[model samples]
Target: MSAGPSADDVPAPDPRLVADLRADLAAVGGDGYRVDAVTALLGLVADAALHREQPLAARRVVTAAVGAGDPLAALVGAFVLGLEVPSDVLATALPRCGLDGAGRLGLLEAVPGGRARARLELRPYAAVDAAGGADWWVASDLGETATGGPLRTDHVLGVGGASTTLARAVVREPVDRALDLGTGCGVQALHLRRHARSVVATDVSARALRVAALTLALDGGAGGDRPGEDGAAPGRGTVDLRRGSLLAPVAGEAFDLVVSNPPFVITPRTDGVPAYEYRDGGMVGDALVQHLVEDVGGVLAPGGTAQMLGNWEHRDGEPWTDRVGAWLDASGLDGWVVQRDLLDPAAYAETWVRDGGQREGAAFDALVGAWLDDLAGRRVDAVGLGLVVLRRPVDPSRPRLRRLEEVPGTGSGALGAHVADVLAAEEQLAGLDDAALARRHLVVAPDVTEERHARPGAADPEVVLLRQGGGFGRAVRVGTAVAGVVGACDGDLPLGVLVGAVAQLLGRPAEEVAAEVLPAARGLVADGLLRLA
Candidate 1:
């Protein structure tokens, strides 16, 4: 048996090769090989199962298609399922690219028995980012499901949950320049291209850079051009690919927007631990996150922001906010951190062990044990995984948006817009005192709704909840008076008028009502339940 494909073998996509490949991929006759087409061929159940890495059902569907000589199935079999396809079938599938071009692109490697195996995993990826919707082909090193083995150490990843999370959470505001700190498979760079005039994508591994180049080229969508020396990378975008570890590639440079799905996974610093370059940052504990938190501001232009996903350790003596907040305070950047998940050491160990392809075996047990021991050594009881958004304050001495909290929920929508809204709101509120704020006309956000819960027989005796339809979908419980104040916020009157009205109706002192509801109003405004008219 010959060796399987490794990081050493990857696509070196040239403009000509990429054009031909893109054309064949977009060919008509039910062989177009797009996300919708592949899903229809595999059926919903098989397609969904494939996403969960249970490919037996998808394989069966593709096998039936192969028997019927379906060209799309052949492409899916070789690329998606990692199954060997007859060379002639592959040739037919990629007619314009042809077998030689695919081989030259390091996309297909010939095997014995007159078959060709896929060198990398390529599939249709669809996303709705801040700019708009796009459907494109993405390529990267095959995963455990496709390879049927442990991942390569330097494996480049395709679009996964974390990458998508970072993408959707990026503020869609157009900017002159943006930076993708670790551009694995170039996923963020593609999204950045939509709004950013130019993108600087940096990665530590040469292999990842190669995969990113190919993905950027082939995923250019319709009417997109290949990358050129003038920085016009494929997809009608400009990217300057750089090589180095976090922040090192573009040290002195500042960008209007900087995004990263960095190597923030905390790993055991043990000799036998197989560190994947895509996830592990080779740091002790959560130091990498701390490092990024403390230093990422350096690259942000004034009034610029950086968004990233990361993990932080929860120890016995240290509060996570203080632990992470110290970094923010020291860095002198406006920062907000939302802790989404807090998992115990054992659970965290099991998660990453399975992530590296160890399911249930002695090796998996050993890896988990190692991670647990490492955590124990540092007295780490829990781990926090969440989103980090930071900005370089226009004024270094006075910053407005320093916040840390637990917002555990599946985010409702593009969080970038929500984040941007909050930032703008904070800055606006900072300029106004409580008395001045009362004079401003405020309206309830369109998506905000009030839910009152009470016993059937009890009237006005229980709870009132203000629910947000978007953002983090937070439900804030309020008193009857606050609810009345919020319900009246329709942009028609100043908040002071609404407060006095509620006070009179409640038969309460105007000062007491103002003291109680005004603070609540401030909180609601920051949470996006209420907005300025």
Candidate 2:
């Protein structure tokens, strides 16, 4: 992989040239301004590319930007394209792309004259020198300012918190075949290509696919490889780009891994306005997410896994766990669903409406009101936000059905690894019965902790509490003998033998201790905080 230029290393374009180009652009007023401005911008990007040793990349960015439309829109399109442009020049050139004298454009700032502008100023592109590339992009969104106006009902968002969160949370393992569903600008697919041998990236929008293709091509070209090498077998690093609805393009094929950051927004689609290709999946009230979960089973190969970020309706009488559990059981796959966040229907509707730049108080509130009516009509009390991971069940006769509360904190690469670990454990213990489980000594995972709480002015003055540090931090209560047995677990002895010895040391009846300790140990094993040896 070849490295692009560093931010500090990029040379600033000549001020005299910029001044002359601006004057020329201003002179070509009315009908000619668009053409003149585009031409000048292309030249500037090309000049920067040449200075940073990537003239081809610069030209590609210019081409893509010219086709994307408008001054602000073209500028945003150019920035993503310019990822391949040597950074040494981009740092100095980016500020110039802004209309403000300060060279800093707030992504949340509304476009002039009620035009919908792309919020590309978010830290989707950052200069890094890792993996042998000077301008390797590091995803960031810290300095992002919130939308100030009412969100356009149909808005095309650039990179945001939810997008990056899903990207990082996706499992990045070496696999023979992979698929990225709803691949907006191909960010998820771009990350998948790093590990998967072959990746098929699909989207419903031609424009999104075009941008994704360009991103792949530029990034690959700058790294000295051809982009668009899709459909090739494992280890080839090829990505097949497809344009279609979810799973429709790859109907017959089964992949080792599949991932999606689908258009999961639960919003009301009114009248004839076209839904934003990037955000709306055209299904009503969590239907898109439900469809993905239901259909993914048909495409995942045996031993394969699928990970998705989804939202589901939380009806008044239904427990979120029961709703998700039903989906998993019906899918015929061993699955784990972690509900990361919850929002009441009104709160959820308002949050997303504002997200699209619909911040005008009454207008935004009205839009949100419409969404709540839709949800209420559908019996949706709230929305459950979550990450779901599924593994194709090996046994047809018996399928795994497990649903737990959400894991705390943001799910990232480490969380992906944790899911992989959980799957491995499930497989290892698939057929083990009580006798076999007793023979294996399970260690209380390091993430499990015990706490003692003291009560004042009480007959029974103390309580012992068991807490799991990872996953959902589920709490349990246990006796001293069970705690000692857990503490001594170092993968050194069988459970039966360890419990037997502990009972003797504590002067507790062996049978009595066995009844209490065994169930707690089994529960720990099932929760994946303990590894059964």
Candidate 3:
């Protein structure tokens, strides 16, 4: 295996090589050739690793290629890990590797087979540049294409779905201090820098942190470099990078915001060994996620927020909400847990195991069996996956817990706004009474559109339809009673009183009207179209 450059022996990227790489990447017509060459190189190394069972040796070859001062090095690393690294696209990035003075190549090199490929991608630099420079780069496996094959346990992938979801979900308000825990490839940290005065990014894997730092430096995402003539530094955010598990590195410090996309895969290690670095949290069950949820409150300042994407087990005879609620309750933080998706045990096991490359045959079945057994042993029946938003309250009264089922039709960006509303309302609730609520004006949600249909053949040809604009475009029949209640919700009446008045107008029992309208009314409130008085 080839070795990397030693401290004294490492040479700077050759200026000519850097220029050639940049030109090649920028060259218009050579995209196919670049992708083919890079992917072929990755395949060759993967085959070699599989034949020899020496993963590190295979990785060394990729490192050498990147260290050769060619942009193709990083391309090869991304490709080997199943990331969509278009040669033509990355060619434009070659100049950056050399321009930013980012030293050291930290590539995402994965063993050729297992679930690893699904989770991370490898990258490498020609050399390690000094820290705190004006230029840096940080790349993650967000928006990368999936290679339609079985996942390898240690496969590092390029960008994909989970990465972007977490990125957009993070709170973007400006803050004095912020932390990106489990900062895989530094994606969250890079984003956090925009709003935070000071940002700290930490990860359990040294390799991940190294790549993250390099990505930030090369991409000018982390704040360090001076602004160019345009007044934009290549790297503008002041980010402090650390290597540690979860919150271990920043034990005593509290922050205004904390974000994480953790390794929450609940898979068991065979032979007492972890399957991958990118996805496995290395706990027996959901312990890792539980620990993160349970401990985050201690590190959050009063009124600070923690947002994360996590997976929780659904046990037989146990409601998913109750299980997640317990975590929030234990944390002593006001929180909202929304289960956006759920998977049956069999489906969940197959999805993750197949992600590791075990498909639906005997090998796959055995893996599934192991997963089922693990779940059964612990009485887990399903897997609940979604986002958790927690607010550390200044008052420290019992924390509020709101559980919501997934409304796939709703927009995620809107959900962020809803969270803000929930927090605001929670704070104002102390001063609010039924009479106060009665005086508030509520706007009908834009998403809720009312359509009046006229049927010429009917005795009373008019019908009102309440339609939701997103998701599946679900439509509900709204009788006059419902319509009257909605029309009267101009924020001037308490919801309870509005229901009573509408019932009286329609000559119906208030109890029956209340039963039907209250739920829908609350939904409107939660969706931000209505406000509690």
Candidate 4:
């Protein structure tokens, strides 16, 4: 309820308190105070559901759990579940660091009648990336679920859907140096450490950098230190936190990889509209995402990859690809964009207005009007929300890959590995001509299956669908010729031989079959449906 800490007055977390808190949490249960333990202790199914977003659902159980002298549950109840506890109970729970120490750490504040409430929200974070599954504690400002109101303008976000989406979308590859731009709470920076030898996390808000520093310290598997005067060393994998807007902090520095879940929300530049620093980049329309795409290349080393999430405006008659592709053309980076979802002006406005915790009332209506007017003035029809992957080619003279398409609901597993495969395929395909490609042996990926659909009485199938069981879960409809080529791919013979054999069976010229199937085969290879033997 106290308006949270300002940028300048942001309190540094005490290392002793953090250690005590970690030990206190570990005493309760394994996984370091997991959500399931709290839910099971509370015995409330409704409280366990994160989609509900009502933190008060487990109040009774939280109070009871705290009263029962469960230190982990007490901390979870007070900080995560957002409940007030008596000063004595809190002191008993965190005996190492009493209420005074907690107050100094900016975690909780004392209330009347010997009671105290948590100011900072803390919870266990679990992730499964290329390095396998891991757990850590993350601390950030209380959200609307706890505060029961709109988020503060400079709110530091926890592990939300957007951050999770970006975490999965990023291509995880081992590199010497990586950068996490707009590193809110340092989620991406943590992921970056799994592969990159060193990470540089930068943000515009000092408050956000403070929260990120706290997050990095709490999740201290790697060395938790800011970059040195000469940057990070080779094997230490330092997590360096910097304060600046966008790429200004990293100017004149080139990174091997850069990942961001940036502040890409488009907002009206009109007066009276609150610009949340975590979401809005203080730009007109979709320029923030554009600026990142265009300018991020400056900091990317040759052969470096930059993966980010963004929103783009689509005007009437103009395709979303053209609108977003223009930014890539200007960036001069090889780009792959996948527009996952699209929203009309009305729907987009409603979504953002509600995101700010504004209910459907007069003030909400006024804000919605401003959004609509801004869109109309710019001749915008809809907005596309998607993931972008850009790579600075080692050889700039070649024609760069510019693929813009719609790929939605790609499933829940880590897509980073898949993305890396696709990029490698792109690079391999770039070097191979048609004749060279035909000479290489190809094999259908293990997860791929072929399905034949036909009428009940028909012996011959009317349609064939090659579906992928892993990766992007894409289904490619193919003709019999291509299907025969795929079925014959046992890593036995080169693709040219298989095409020739199929051509002989189908009573067609070998050259004709080779020309037709070769293009489709290349497409399949790029998407990981087929692999080189």
For candidate 4, the 10 contiguous residues with the lowest summed lDDT are 227-236
Question: What's every prediction's RMSD, in angstroms?
Answer: 1.8, 12.3, 9.4, 2.7
- Write down the TM-score of every candidate: 0.97, 0.70, 0.70, 0.93
* Ten contiguous residues minimizing lDDT sum, candidate 3: 125-134
| Shift of residue 491 alpha carbon in model 2, Å | 0.9
For 1-533, candidate 4 gives per-residue lDDT tens digits of 22666665447666766667656665555545766666666676655554477555566667776777666666776787667777776776676667787777677888888778887787777788877776766777777777667778888888888898888878876899999999988788878877887789999988888877767655546444333211221123677889899999999999999999989998999998889878899888999999999999999999999999999999888888888899999999999998888899999999998888777889989999999999999899999998999999999998899999887774547888888888888888998999999999999988899999999999878999999877778899998889999999989999998999999999999998888899999999998899987
Q: lDDT per model, in order?
A: 0.86, 0.61, 0.59, 0.81
> For model 2, how big is the CA root-mean-square deviation?
12.3
Question: Candidate 1's residue-wise lDDT over 365-476, tens digit each?
Answer: 9999999999999899999999999999898666457899999976887888988998888888877788998999999998898898889988775989999998888899
lDDT of 2 by residue, 236-305 (tens): 2677889899999999999999998889888787753235556788888888888888789899998788
Arrange candidates, best lDDT first. Answer: 1, 4, 2, 3
Question: Order of all candidates by TM-score, from best down to worst?
Answer: 1, 4, 2, 3
After superposition of all CA atoms, the RMSD between model 3 and the true structure is: 9.4
- Over 4 Å off, model 3: 1-157, 221-224, 227-236, 272-274, 358-362, 408-414, 429-431, 451-479, 488-523
Write model 3 residue lDDT over 203-242, tens digit each, in one string: 7776566546544543433433443221222344567778
Where does model 1 exceed 4 Å of error? 1-8, 28-31, 221-226, 229-232
Q: Supply candidate 3's per-residue lDDT for 441.
A: 54
Lowest summed lDDT window (length 10), candidate 1: 223-232
